[model samples]
Target: MSRKPSTSHFLLLLIIIITVAVSAARTSAQSTSLCPSSSVNPEFCPINCFRPDPVCGADNVTYTCGCDDALCAGVRVVKLGPCDA
Candidate 1:
C-alpha cells in the first residue's frame, strides 16, 4: 500500500511556515528599530554597555570580550574585536 500526503499534513506545514516567517519578520523589524538603518540586525545596540575589550557583533556593533557570546540581550557575536568603521 502507498501512502500520500494528507490535508492535515499540508495544513500543519503551512502553519509552521507562517509561524517561522512571522517570527523572522518580527526579528527583522526589531533589528531595524534598534540598530541604525545602515546596519543589518540589532546584534549590537550598545545595550550591553560595559568595559570594552573591543568585540564586534554580527550587526556591526562593538562590545566587550569579557561579555560572553551568549548575551542576554539577544546579540550574536561576530568576532572578538572592534567592528570595522
Candidate 2:
C-alpha cells in the first residue's frame, strides 16, 4: 500500500521552498547591484567634460564627473561625494 504524505511534512517542504526562493532572489539582487571593475567599458561613455561633480563609487574610488563617469567605469555610486581620505 502507498502511504500518503502528512500535512506537517508538506508544510515543511513548502516552507523550505519559499525560504530558498526568497534567498535566491536576495542573492541575485545583491550580485546585480554592484558592477565590478573588471566589467568597465568606456567605449560608449560620454566625453569627460571639464565638469567636476565628484561622486564616490562602491569600490571606494571617486568619479569626479558624477554617475555618468561612474557607470562608464562599471562602478556603482556609494555616495555623491569623494570617498573619505
Candidate 3:
C-alpha cells in the first residue's frame, strides 16, 4: 500500500527553508562591505539619487547611485561620474 507524508516531515521542510533564507540574508548584508554607512544622515546621503548617476564621495571614492540612495551615505559629493556611462 502507498503511504502519505507525515505532518512532522512537512514542518521539518518548512524550518529548513526558513533557515536557509535567513542565512542568505545575513550573507548579503555582510557582503556589502563597500557601503560602510547607511542613508541615515543627509550630510552623506546623495542629493539626487537618480539611477545612471555616479557620485564621488568625501571618502575619496566614487559610487554609482541606486534609486534608493543607500550606497552614498555619510559623505559629500565631489563630482558626478555615473557608472553606467
Highest lDDT scorer: 2
Overall lDDT per candidate, in order of appearance? 0.61, 0.79, 0.59
Q: Candidate 2, residues 1-85: lDDT per residue as tens digits? A: 9999999999999999999999999998887733244343578686455879888998999988777788887777888778898
Show where candidate 3 strays beyond 4 Å: 35-85
Give candidate 2's TM-score.
Answer: 0.47
Put down candidate 3 lDDT per residue, 26-76, tens digits, no spaces: 999777554334545556555564455556555666666632253435455
* CA lDDT, candidate 1, residue 62: 75
Q: What's the TM-score of each model vs. the native? A: 0.39, 0.47, 0.43
Q: Which consecutive 10 residues in model 2 have the weakest lDDT in total?
A: 32-41
Better of 1 and 3 by TM-score: 3
lDDT against true structure, model 1: 0.61
Task: Give candidate 1's TM-score.
Answer: 0.39
* Residue 37 Cα positional deviation in candidate 3, in Å, after optimal superposition: 14
